[model samples]
Target: MTHRTLFLTGAAIALVATAGLGFGLGRLTDKTPAAAEGHAEEADHEENFIALSVADAAKAGVLTTTVGRGGGSELVLPGRVALAVNALAALGAPVSGAVERVHVAVGDHVSAGAAIASLRGAEGANARASVDVAAAGARAAAAAAARDRRLFEAGVVARQDWEASQAAADKAQAELRAARAQVTAQGTPSAGGLATLRAPIAGIITRVDVRVGAFLTQGGLVAEIADQSAVEYVFDAPPASVGAIKVGDEVLVQRPDGGEDSARIVAVAPSAVDAGAAVVRAKPTAPAPRIGSIVSARVILAKGAGGLTVPADAVQTLEGRAVVFVVEPKGFRATPVITGRAAEGAVEILKGLNGGETIAGKGAFRLKAELGKGEAGHED
Candidate 1:
């Protein structure tokens, strides 16, 4: 046979084989082209599934939450994490004294009652002396009261005299307690009578003005500390929205890093402030983000309002499609979803999910990354 003829015959055979293979696949699937395409897509979806145990998912911080009913409307407001008023400490000089030693500096973290500075002066000496004096007075008064009580019982003293002595003893004892409380609250004066200024709360010191040997008057600012963990979200809402916003309403706070946290409204200003703008406050369910980090707060005006919602972070992009990891008995499956309006750190699931399905929420990004790694490994 000629080479050209041989080539043509081989080409025809290749075409026939291709057609037979296609027909065989169709018969095996018992599906039309569209149906087969769909089946292949489903297989691809299955491949993206992550076979992570619930324990492993928890370890990875892939926290799962039930898809919940969303409110009819959401109130989105600009807000920020702020230090609680009580969490801030402006450490001041407890007495008019010169700083003898500085124990901490700006940016230092100190536990509650940790010393910040030492001041030695007559004030501390006087406080120590007052405690000693109160103790001595208490001892003397108690001895006198005991003598009077015995004399009265022996008919050697009047009842009024015994009562007076008892009163004196009680007053002296109260003074002693006050002195001791003062000593403890202001820190025990050292052997040399140095008063140690200490942190009132656990926090990071933001400022320090005292230096060794510097004289500071009582109540003078020595340093400032802020408990970063003691933070709440504050939002300024329009006056029109203030009426609908209420304490104890659910709040969804979105951090700059894309993490979402749930909170409850803690305070709503009785009236508008700052050019008629109303203020709202929320207590976060978890430790808040850094103070001053700009965040958006979605306040659920009416809880149990109506539609299915999941955390915004629950939705992720996989292969250019919006997907969420729906939990399964054995593992998780990435489900394609159609999303609607988002409010309160939650996005509405318009389709592709039934209410009550558990899905990866706050740390859903971890699962997305995990699924990507799985796809990469399969390709290799």
Candidate 2:
């Protein structure tokens, strides 16, 4: 062959080889069946995550909640929300010391006996020691009082002597009682002198005033907590209407915010004076309305009902099944759930939920309508 012909033939061979190599690599890199299935699953998961910002959620009127077991029996009455006696607590330092840590923040839920903050108690050790000392003194005083009583009864001591001894014992007892109060007011300290401030009752932290490393004085406010669920509805029942109102009646509470909850009559007291309106106190079965909110309360007379429930509006029907839009980190997820009886503007949940899930309330319908747009309105 000539030189030009030879060069052209070699170039054609190289081009064909390059094409074959590219085809082979493309085949190898193509996704396998299993890999393709996995990709679909991931896409599905991403699709399930609804993307809504906090502000949008607020504008949509989405109210979140942790599901709680509730009483479904019902009644209707007008009432105002009020904190239960002892439901509100303004916790202060157990003893004068610098704050070591604040364990909770505003809007956090806390259980009874759970620690909310910790501080080094300057008088912790001394307080414990004082309790020990007082206890010994109390024991000694009791023993002496017993001895004097026996002597007086036996006619072996003057009446005045016995009386004086009794008085001395009383004085000692008072001193001991005072000393013990000091210890109790300041919780027992850890070996390292840390005094943990615990919630007096299960509640929500409404305020936090202590900062880490800040010196707190004894009795200085550290935080404030209110048992959101530990509230009672006070209704003024007319004397004629009061006869029908009785304890143990169920109440469905409607708040101004368009949220609903249930409570049960715990007390019904007539006015101390003549013809005054009777007072009816109902303890809430679910988390309560904010203190001081005027609410419409429905009292149900029946019994044999109890289950996990949320606001009736919170439950929505989609695709022929009941679903609630549960709040998620990114947005809301429509979770299929089994529901029971409906009463008092609320519905019972039989399955498909554990407690402590934040869910959409008032604005639930908006979510359902938005979600009804299917994969079109909500995109991954």
Q: What are the per-residue Cα lDDT tens digits for candidate 2 across 1-380?
A: 69999999999999999999999998988888999999777646344346676569878787776686787434345789898877899998879988888899999999988888888865987777776787788788778888988999999988888888788788888988887787677877754567788898788999999899899888899989998666778987655446556787777788898888877889988866786677899888777767898988766643464557888989988877788888877788888886656878888776667767988888788877766665674453
lDDT of 1 by residue, 1-380 (tens): 69999999999999999999999997887878898789767556347688787789999888888988866547678988898768888988877788889999889999998989998877777778889999999999999999999999999999999999999999999999998887765567854578888888998989999888788887889999998888999898866567667789898899899989999998998543447568898988987878889999877764455667889999999887789899988789999976656767889765678787989888889888887887886686
CA shift of 200, model 1, Å: 1.4
**Where does candidate 2 clash, by residue pair?**
74-299, 74-300, 75-298, 75-299, 75-300, 76-298, 76-299, 77-297
C-alpha-based local distance difference test score of model 1: 0.84
Query: How many Å off is the CA of 58 in candidate 2?
Result: 64
Q: Name the candidate that leads on TM-score.
A: 1
Residue 38: error of model 2 in Å?
99
Candidate 1, position 69, lDDT: 84
Best by lDDT: 1
* TM-score of model 2 vs. true structure: 0.39
| Poorest 10 consecutive residues by lDDT, candidate 1 | 270-279
